[model samples]
Target: MTDARPLAFELPPLRAISVAIPLFILAVLLQPSVSARTSRRLRLALLVPTAVLGWISPFRWRIEPVEFAITANFRWGIFSPYFLMLAVWFGAMGESERKNELAWLGFDGKAEKKALGVEEGSTGHSTATKEDGNAGLRPRANGTLLAPKPRPVSPLASPALSLVSNSSLNDQLPTPSPSPPVDPVQPPSVVDAPPSSVNVPTLTSRKNATRSYSQRHHPLRILLDAAHLLSAMRMIGYAGGPRARDLPPAPKNDKTFFRDRLLAFYNAHLVSSACLALQVLDRDGILASYLSYILPHDAAVFVSATLARLCIGVSLWVQMKIGFNGFAILFYLLHRGTNAFLDTLQAILPRRWSEELTWRSRFDVREYPALFDNPFSKMGEGGVTKFWSARWHFLFRATFTSLGYKPTLALSKRLGVPKRVAQLLGAFVVFTLSAWMHWQALVSARYNLHPSPAGLAFAAAHSIPLTSIYPPPSTSLSFLDRNGTFVFFLLQPVAVFLESLWVALTRKRVSGWAGKVWTALWVVVLGQAVVGKSWLALGLVHGLPPLHLWSWHRFVLPTCSLAPMPVFMR
Candidate 1:
């Protein structure tokens, strides 16, 4: 890595981006235009080669020598929107393509989902699906696909899932069974009046009714009361509510304009990914170094991706001014841009394309929000758990959970590790697996190329912090950071474990906001650190004022080479 210094402006190695990005976009847009089977084949055909090439390390160990298998600087060339875009391509391929991939591997696509108890259309709103030989199952709180099952005749009990009611009062009343989907929010008039023969309580007078503390003004609450009175009616009326998870397949003729996919991916992934690829573009050898960055590359992005343009602007400015490569900036921001790119494609591509990713929902954002505390500002109410699980982009959530979370639990049981120890060790394993996946990007490499410092640094950074999560952080700032890190995932079970300890010790919850604030601060601080040297490595920070005036320059005038500093001007 070169230190930031004034030098002749280099064109930088963006040549591959032109080909890689266009190829990526062309593949995605064309996906829906073809049959699902062909689409899947095309995506994997594009992805496999790109991935194999991406991990071909150019550098040889701490020695900093560039070697090559396919090209002089194979790694950088692959990274130039090549590997990144391919990953994006694989990710954006809709569910149809995904299922096709599974079929090729000889697995029935939906068979596993059925095995997992993830049946669809169980709600009365989706009763139309009952005719498909799947009837009378409800979505669990943790939405997964289900298989066909018999209706619960008792309404409260089923072979599929057991219901443990908190209140015994429910036992006295008839079981609240599935009724024709009704809008709980509908007006009381939508419900029938109680029968005259049935003994019923009524307000003695209008004044009493008006003054009653429990007056039913809200439509839904009123509907609930009506249903209780009409309990025998079974609330069996027709209505509908859309299940949030049942995303539709991609449009057969997706209308994503040719130019939009090109421009969107270029600005987001191409720009930074291309920039990052420059450092090792000319190196050779795979035995020394391989892998990507610190925090995992996210697939679950765009829950906070409104800032795509802002991140892009910052990156370009940093690049033009420094006259170095902008690769390091990719480390800080590519996930957001890639996510934004996918979001753009999804809008025009198909729903299946985006099902691979997860994001923040519009509902209960504060209490049960996605990775971001607020997407617009890129602000997060960070805590370790929140950052890792809910707040940070979940681009790789489904992937990571499958590869790391479940397998770790299974392995732990086999090894007879305690559940508590397993969880702690499992986190390390997950981070380590993240490292290995980064390595999997190599097109050609030797076995000795293991544990690149960059990946080790990433894994160890989190792993060490994790050990301190227990003992409930101390008053020291480092300890506090540790506690918060452990909770959110930067550090572990310590901060998360402290939740129980705090409640036990003080009978009150810890101030979540404090941890959030610390997490946010750490993000800002660590972000600068993570990107700083890498910028130097990528040559993006060779001392010059940033080109923040691109919009003005583009339409009004063409800016010259990177703007010089006051010292240089003097």
Candidate 2:
């Protein structure tokens, strides 16, 4: 009571407790259950709220006030290990169950059999115990005799017996003897039995049995095996298997293992994508499929990490421009490494999807490349006509066309929109998202929000030159120029837009000229959003341009840097 007056200025502990209680409760309520479906749902439901709370809580709690302290990122750090453990645990559980199932199915040598009443050599007089139930061994009529019931001869035994008989026929012969009275009391022992015509199990049957056992005990083993298999298929060249015929052939002495590693990396990427695609294909409903398998909580971790890395990297770059050394190089390297990983992934994805789709349809890998190649080949040869004739094109067109005819279709339904409109919309969306991501990057970098003169100059120079006179450079060139702000702004939007156009045109929904113009304008705005003036201006004026001039002089002019610039020019 005496200290109550002094304590009045201090916030009550209950205030913190009150805020935390609800969050804790919500987290517990939203925690994923054991069921994959339930877990997935919980994960999705928790994502936005958790992220919001994570970010907000940091500010509320002042964990990292300058940066967004969303629980999403922290959750990734805290829960990722647990999530991974869960995946492994579930995977192992699935494997063990499969093994048990296989054993139950008689693939295991210890598979349950009808039990004999007595031990192999025990007298029949001994009472059959329940404990001896499934023993295959049986007591013979003679108290001392023990034998197994003869199993049915397999079809393979005859040919093997015939081969043996033919080889040994001339070497051994036995004289015929008159039949004698059979002994009543004697026990029979199977000693030196002629290599029984009982068909020796073939290698194939043994393999089948092994597979059966594996499948039974570990149902998920097959799935995990398939996962590994798909992964292996993806890694064929990278993991020291055969090279892809479709890809450029490897050099004989290519010791760098670049091709192999690249192939493996690509394959791994495809396997992940394929896993997601499979979930998409298996699930019922449109968004459900996309959300369920495609958008697992673990995936959010990956995406968040990528985004955070990018943001951190750009922030460091900006800080470096402003003479701040903190975190710049680390961010740069992280971004580069991540990009390389993603590039490998992008390269192999289409091939993986094509293969998956083909295999799912035809149940054969041989047809996969042909299936994927046919559409592209057709497009190259027949252009729009060939595309229309392709199966996928027809399917896509028909889906939208059918949607258009539906009486319940809403005005907001994009299904019946003209192909061009759809494409434009798609392009716009992708470009906008990309721009927003870039803008976030700028913010992270502490760059000025205003558009910089250097960025504008670079864009104007590159766009006017490349779009006007030349065919767009190869993807390799684009990749090389990826570091440049203007290049990315100009190129990425255009590329996304073109991709949208291709999709729409393929579906026969080509937009009018005005729509295309509008789309182009949107790209410019999006580009501006991504490339903050403060960051771009410094790089353009002091960094990239000077480096370019230096290289050009050193190699091309041979004495250019040595020469003085005009006073006015300087």
Question: CA lDDT of each candidate?
Answer: 0.30, 0.27
**Model 2: residue 122 alpha-carbon error in angstroms:** 54
**How high is each candidate's TM-score?**
0.34, 0.24
Instruction: Indicate the TM-score of model 2.
Output: 0.24
**Deviating ranges (above 4 Å) for candidate 1:** 1-50, 56-131, 137-382, 429-512, 525-540, 543-570
Best by lDDT: 1
RMSD of 1: 21.6
What's the distance in Å from true for residue 402, model 2?
22
Q: Model 1, 230-327: lDDT tens per residue?
A: 21111111011011111111112212322322233334434443332232221111111222232222421211121222232244433322221122
